[model samples]
Target: MLSPNLLAWSVELFIKEPGSNKTVFWHQDITYWGMGETDDEVTAWIALSDVSVKAGCMRFIPGSHKGGIVDHEDTFSADNLLSRGQEIGGIDESQAVHSPLKPGEMSLHHGRCFHASGANRSDDRRIGLAIRYVTPEVCDQAPGRDWAMPLRGEAPAGGWSCIAGPRGLFHAADLALYDSIIEGQTATLAAGAEQDVSMYGGTKA
Candidate 1:
């Protein structure tokens, strides 16, 4: 659920294979997002499979959203699922709250919440869908421009342009648009850097 002024910004599926060691590092969603100034964004993480601590369920630092953005370091580990393997510093793991959920269940968190997931140690795979919602008042701050779909209310003008929904999977026009968008996103995420540090707007660790 989102404010009336907000729209669906993006959606992504994250999967952790059974017995995989890949992990999502501790970091705030806003840090990697282009959403500017206003942290008027929320993420709905919907579980597609039975998820638990052993299956790498998400963990959050309660009330951590109020602290604002903090410093992060790129671990560059092969098992890190983050774009840059970015991890927030000085975290007290003892304060973390593990969030386990059944299929179809979901958890909502502010964009600035500190969160992460451990390596999956279960016998079954774990899948989660993360849907991000952002208010039109938020500005895109990444290198390349960004686009968002209007899910509710009138779509905002400027900053992001409107895009038509794909009529079918792998449609020619859709594929072209997808390629163009991916190019822009890759450039924006790369930020002209040669390594994973490019994703971080601050000094590399």
Candidate 2:
């Protein structure tokens, strides 16, 4: 589990919203939280703008989180591990949520939620930021120079910080419940108020 350090978040594909009919393709984020037995994972998907269906807002199959992760194929080759059009044989496309998002607002869901995005037809950038959280009980299986962070143990409350560690990694079951007990640790540590990054934005939503 990621507690203090391995809080993985991605800014997005830096999307190209040229017009409609451009697809985001289909793929699942199963590789992040361990493949099958990964546990206690939560994610927050934030749209940087007033996202809409035409602007390529997120789409989620309502309640798809409960179904667990379905196998998926790479729909977009730009960010895929394989070449484009590679029909991945696991994603649960039939139950995907075409859920749309709003700027400043975010959607929190299980790591396994069935979701994806579409091509943006509107004349705006369809940018998104996704943040994921894991308890200090799930260790990452992949390794080597990939940049991992340890999220637990004794650390300063937050002043001009740069989490120092050996490539940033937590022992999963060893890290203390620092995140759970810290409460408003982020806000309290900020020089002034918070930036909504408490959950990634620096402040609480």
Candidate 3:
């Protein structure tokens, strides 16, 4: 399991050009959270495969979290997450250390950490499981806007509410599914969880 106490988690695979996954961009995680400060979140990244710097591993900015969350940029590219911060003097990339791990290993990071991954220059896919954790204190931002919406099922004791604020990000294919859920075409999150009952990292665990 990734984090026994996951607030949100996903199982994802990264597949880029064959042996050309070396180029990478940088970005912060708080950009996905429509509400609350970056200082209010945390993440646990668990690798399901052997991850190396040369194989598109991730690195972290030294104490960048202390600077608080930077204002998010609208660009959709991930390659700029690293170079942009360095070019703008907001981060020192040279000081970062490439952190690698074996399968079943995990990296726990402060939500505000300045992090980036190398390109997936390898021939194989980069596989990992990630879990985003929160203290149940942060408000949801997926109510309105171009972000996620609410499913019109049974509401909580307080009535139907959002678990995240509107975030202008999506995986394209998943956006339509999300929108449908918002329009009462889906079930509640708790109900979905009960149906699948996945672990913190989207694995059976």
Per-model lDDT: 0.76, 0.46, 0.49
CA lDDT for candidate 1: 0.76
lDDT of 3 by residue, 1-205 (tens): 3223224322233333435533434556654445436443466778777777656777888787777667543332333322122222355677887878787898878766777777665666555566555433345444332122232333223212335433556766557646554443122222222232211111111
What candidate 1 gets wrong by more than 4 Å, as runs, is 142-144, 192-205
Instruction: Report the poorest 10 consecutive residues by lDDT, candidate 3.
Output: 196-205
lDDT: the better of candidates 1 and 3: 1
Per-model TM-score versus the true fold = 0.89, 0.55, 0.58
Tens digits of lDDT, candidate 1, 64-178: 9887688777666667776777788888999999999999999999878899999889989898888888777777775227777777877777666556678798899989876
